[model samples]
Target: MSDKTSEAKVHFRSNAKVHEVDLRIREANVRLCQLCLWRNRKGIGFHIAPSSSSLPVICMVESNSPASAGGLKICDAILAVNNKNISEANYQQATTIIKTALNTKGRVDLLVVEQKFYKELKKNDISMISSSAKILVTPHSMPADFFNFPKHQPRTCDIHVNQDNKTFGFEVVSGDDNIGIYIQEVAPDSAASNAGLRKSDRIIEINGTYIEQDSNMNYQHYLWIAQASVYVDIGDDKSKLEATKLFEFVLYENPLHDNARLNLAILHFNPSHVHALETCAIVGLQMNHPTEAFIDLNQVLHFQPSSAPLLANRSVIQQFLDDNRNQSC
Candidate 1:
């Protein structure tokens, strides 16, 4: 029974786009929408209706609250909460996720696919979750060409290394105990292929642990960076001070180094890194750092938009930016 249920979930997920094809409606008739909500004393201001009748729908969106403010409508089906696929979850399970995110993070990012014609999809024997229904942002999966790989451009990607249905078919050529590891080859249509791993992509850090790198000066930069990680890991004020200086030295050497900048940002508050990029951006904006806020916001927008963000609702993002920029001004 469990195996059959899991198989059903995968099928339902795969056929999400079938409605668009069968009905000949617009290709993006059911694109996912992310609603970022900030919790307040008044609550997030939305109610999820019983799904016994259908997929979970927003029964009511309180006026002038995070729900309405975040562009949630009257019937947006709750697809996922905090990137967890809940299409198969019950009402209690769904609400628990929302409550947890609000209680822990004080904010939540919801991926909903509320379509006007959504409720009618059952007539066509279709489900909501699709092949494109991604709750979490992942790495690009483009084929790697030899000439296309470059050293100067480094981007962060999250790969599900250990998964039941996925195979990690990439070869790690060489790695130093201190500098970094490199990807030598990736099999086609494999886990590494889906993760956009290229032949020349260097594996600098794994699960936040720095490893093996090149030049005497470069080696010095990495050494301090590693030491900073240790100091931060030690979780003491003196260690924080040492980490601060080490991270600062790394930034001084390479102004464009994002890890150094992110480390510095986290180190500015807590060295344990409990306050991550989003929190830092929030605090930065609150502290009147518009440049930092805008930079972080734009980076997030660019990375997470996917093809769905470019639809007719591009103004939603643009207006958001304009509004924030005006306030900062």
Candidate 2:
């Protein structure tokens, strides 16, 4: 038979929960492979050895053999083959599964756990070659709300200010031709500095009205505009920080209506902020804005092309966009 036909003959089976096992392996930074092994009538292609507990382990893989090409490594624990759970079976039973698979098909599928997981199991005093099965927790058994609950919410705080307070100890500048207001400076003892309001915080709203950049307004008017709206910043050093702190406290407690998206955009302003880009892309996907998500992910991939997680996320977004386009047609 041709190499392709011969390779297709081998089919291996695994007893371990594929997703759970794959997750653990990935967490452990181990590569997992589905091997297709083929043997002639004389069984010259592959060889297996029994471990101390009489369970099968990969002892040797021939160079250029089907096993080697399939990424079977030395000392890999044989978990199952062709639906047979070798962990609970004797050497003969395991070999029988391999032999039966080879006879029925031209090749057999071998499912083996990588060495790292085996070492971990051994380090924990668990027998690596034992016939006892390890029971894994299934997702269906978890609480119904386990995946539905939000893990975190925006933190809020309130700051009280006396009427004597004035200057908040910060300078505000219109961003990019007076399009939006941003914190330009925080004085050393200013209220803004004390309130955790970082420089470059884009002011989205004042009191209840959202601040808009108006080229017609002068910078001084913008500064004095919010004076009567519960907080004002003056030239005094003593109350500057206090008023600024109160303003920031109120702002943090009541984020803008589109705070999530705004926060992500602000974070991505730093070019090397990969996590920010990743979060932006994820939030975009969640909001059904695949185009936005793709833009963020593409920018990230340009920085780290080999990032597997980023590539996977991009693929998902691409698939979603493709599916949506197809449905619209």
Candidate 3:
């Protein structure tokens, strides 16, 4: 049967020259480019910046390629772009400028103070993209009189809330490009989850206190101290010192504090507390109970139920279990 199947198979070869084959491939590639040209045309934009450090009112408009037809001259000192205060503009504020221009169709009006020529103009119309293209242009024309752009508003309620120490929880963590806390996970059957802590949350503050990066002190050390002192009525400075001493003098402490243990539970409950969880889980696993690591992942899934990462974490626990079985062999 195998011999008959092999005999039935057929193969063919083309004897075309390299140049002829190359031309055919090039033709195929051009078809793909033609199909995607419409998508490319739809994506067009530009940015603006403050003209000088000395002049608070000075501004500058930069033209981006293919979308440059909006009639904005290079070095045009803009007083305002899309009705925003130009003096407040900074590096992060540039994103606001691009978003505003793109959202309002291709129309961008600049309130400019032309520095060299010394002229101020309001409603200086500039089309954000090339006018020569035959593509359909959508007019911005917002509501009769809308207020300023909505996306610029400051965010509130990013921290997940909960009830109490055992049943309620929250966490603060390091963020990218900004000083803030991000909620990575919340546990079900826990206070944080019940209080509405969800996944993908970037917490700006906790208990009205901003989460600033303390350059003078290590955040992980702070976390251990805080967790250790949760239940103790002792002085803040004394409790914090004891917590640090407990971990630092690991061998000498002999027995850890009950307050520290409770704090560890709370930190475990809030998965957004990354540094503390990593510390405890590593110690627990090294001490021969991999289940501690599994519990941390469970807290992660409480907030992000659909996460593939949490699913893979379950597989890791199973591997550890398998290792234990093999060891007994």
Clash count list over all predictions: 6, 13, 2
lDDT of 1 by residue, 6-80 (tens): 999989876765645544323324434344443222477677875654356665554344554454555456665
Judging by lDDT, tell me the better candidate of 1 and 2. 1
TM-score of each: 0.29, 0.28, 0.22
lDDT of 3 at 250: 32
lDDT of 3 by residue, 46-148 (tens): 3343333422232222112222233233333444445554534554565466456656654444443333432322222222111111232222332221213
Measured by TM-score, the strongest candidate is 1
What tens digits encode model 2's per-residue C-alpha lDDT throughout 230-312?
Answer: 33334344444444444444345444424333333443355468877777777776666789889999999988999999999
Better of 2 and 3 by lDDT: 2
RMSD of each: 26.2, 28.3, 22.7
> lDDT (0-100) at residue 130 of candidate 1?
43
Superior by TM-score: candidate 2 or candidate 3:
2
**Pick by lDDT: which candidate is best?**
1
Q: For residue 36, give model 3's deviation from the true position in Å.
A: 22
Worst 10 residues of 3 by lDDT: 29-38
